[model samples]
Target: MMNSPVETIFYIIDETATILQEELSCTYLEAVAETGENLFQDDILQDEVSEVTKKRLQKSYEEANIGEQPNETIRKAFQFAILKGMKENVQPNHQMTPDSLGLFISFLVNKFITTEKQLTVLDPAIGTGNLLTTVLNQMANSNVHSIGVEIDEVLIKLAYVGANLQKHQLELFNQDSLEPLFIDPVDLVLSDLPIGYYPNDVRAQDYELQAKEGHSFAHHLFIEQSIKHTKGGGYLFFIVPNGLFESTQSQQLHEYLHKEVHIQGMLQLPTSLFKNEKAGKSILILQKKKEGIKPPKEILLATLPSLMKQSAVEDILAKIDGWIKQNK
Candidate 1:
């Protein structure tokens, strides 16, 4: 919330970022390529939020008398403040992940995470890095390595700050995920695929070559990319618009999954669960087929009403967990 008469802008950024990271951990580094008018220029906002930066940040926190509030309360206040300030004072361009949806997806995937020494998770369009951070929070474990690829500079900066503040080891990149990219394939691929269409001309010539023309949604391209970058036998949890299941554009994707991947489950999310958007969403869980293994013939699919509670979501996941165990 930079709009408030904050004597120090760094303070708001620092405090609000605490929610993204755990307390007193040094597992990340924050990088912002440039500064905006609302955040001051390079003269004030520089490469890192180090001890010197905190001194400036602390002054504003003291002025606001935020020393007495618990970290959670402060985090909530700071999140709203930044969100409001960004909307009212600064230009709006990015979408933030809702806390409930972030946590819900994380909760659904928790059981699948393991103590494997080389676990790696990737989020191709990691806006603000909330979903990945939420996954780490739910696990409350530090053994996993996380990575995110984002195109927006500002969102990646915020994500880097949050990952560092939480003391979680994260690798962040600012690049177009739709283009030809190189990263070692990972074990788990998680994403809230950004909505919209990619330009037919700019899209890589051979991207998902099987998809026909006039079927050029960005989300479809991203899903294809995620599948390519996922290890055999690894898993993917994508929160995509429900339209993917019905759209003719996604016919190629459906065919590919039917032949090469096992549809673990699909959990329909509440409509309007995401702020500022009207598309119905669902979490599609899939596992890449290892060599010599055939895809499962049956899939587990369920829907939750818009009015369902957190506990109810948990119950539904528990049922899905049981099914996974039986089928595995």
Candidate 2:
């Protein structure tokens, strides 16, 4: 029996990446990035690798035909490769948002922005571009302009390669996301926000959510930056910690949200998604303030069932649909 498209693509990626890793004496993830770039360009760009290894890589690439695979299939295969690479060199911020959660967020984005014919979306913490591309693939609007920002060079390189492989024209910036963005305000913003204190106290001072006397929460600053880059009445969806509003600096966050945006909803993700209860997170929905826009009559709130339970997930989605219809 023939291997499925996802498995085939993943095999090609892994095989070529391993060959590159051995030849270049580089890490698995770096080799994966190189492999993805080669796939996208449809040529081996590396001169350092031996001719023997190059011929092996060329042979592997020729065996797999990924040109006809669906975008999601390609994305999923690349995601699996990235997940494997991450395990080999575990970094705290190198996590990819799970596929189920990415799909859930995509649903919300499509439902909320149904009326728009064109859209621009931004992801400030676009690690490897997995979550951003996932949402982009599911967007109702075909005419979308997307931007992604990440500070790490390797991660951004991976994101660039993945976006190219998926045929997404993403405007990716490799810089500290909190630094001033040169782009115009976008229609929507999304992020699986990086948690923990931002080390640069001086840069943190520029944000309204900055702590009065210490390093500010990176997640809090991300929310502020996302809002800043969003057009008035535009929407922002964030995957945030469950205790986002209960932190020691919650008051500042509360005050900031009250003044600049309207809290549209909060849906606690299934506890089963996390390693422990303490690590669980929620999807936070917010809309930037505008002169005519009003808060939803009732903020949509619910704890999602385990995504593995298909029937329970459908029921929750139905309830959400009803809420959206009534509110709209």
By TM-score, who's the top model here?
2
- Model 2, 116-180: lDDT tens digits are 87888999999999999998888745788899999999899999998888788789989999999
Q: How does residue 41 of candidate 2 score in lDDT?
A: 81
What is the TM-score of candidate 2? 0.98
| lDDT minimum window of 10 residues, candidate 2 | 61-70
What are the models' TM-scores? 0.75, 0.98
lDDT of each: 0.66, 0.92
lDDT against true structure, model 2:
0.92
Clashing pairs in 1: 1-81, 1-82, 21-166, 22-166
lDDT of 1 at 281: 83
Give the candidate number with the greatest lDDT.
Answer: 2
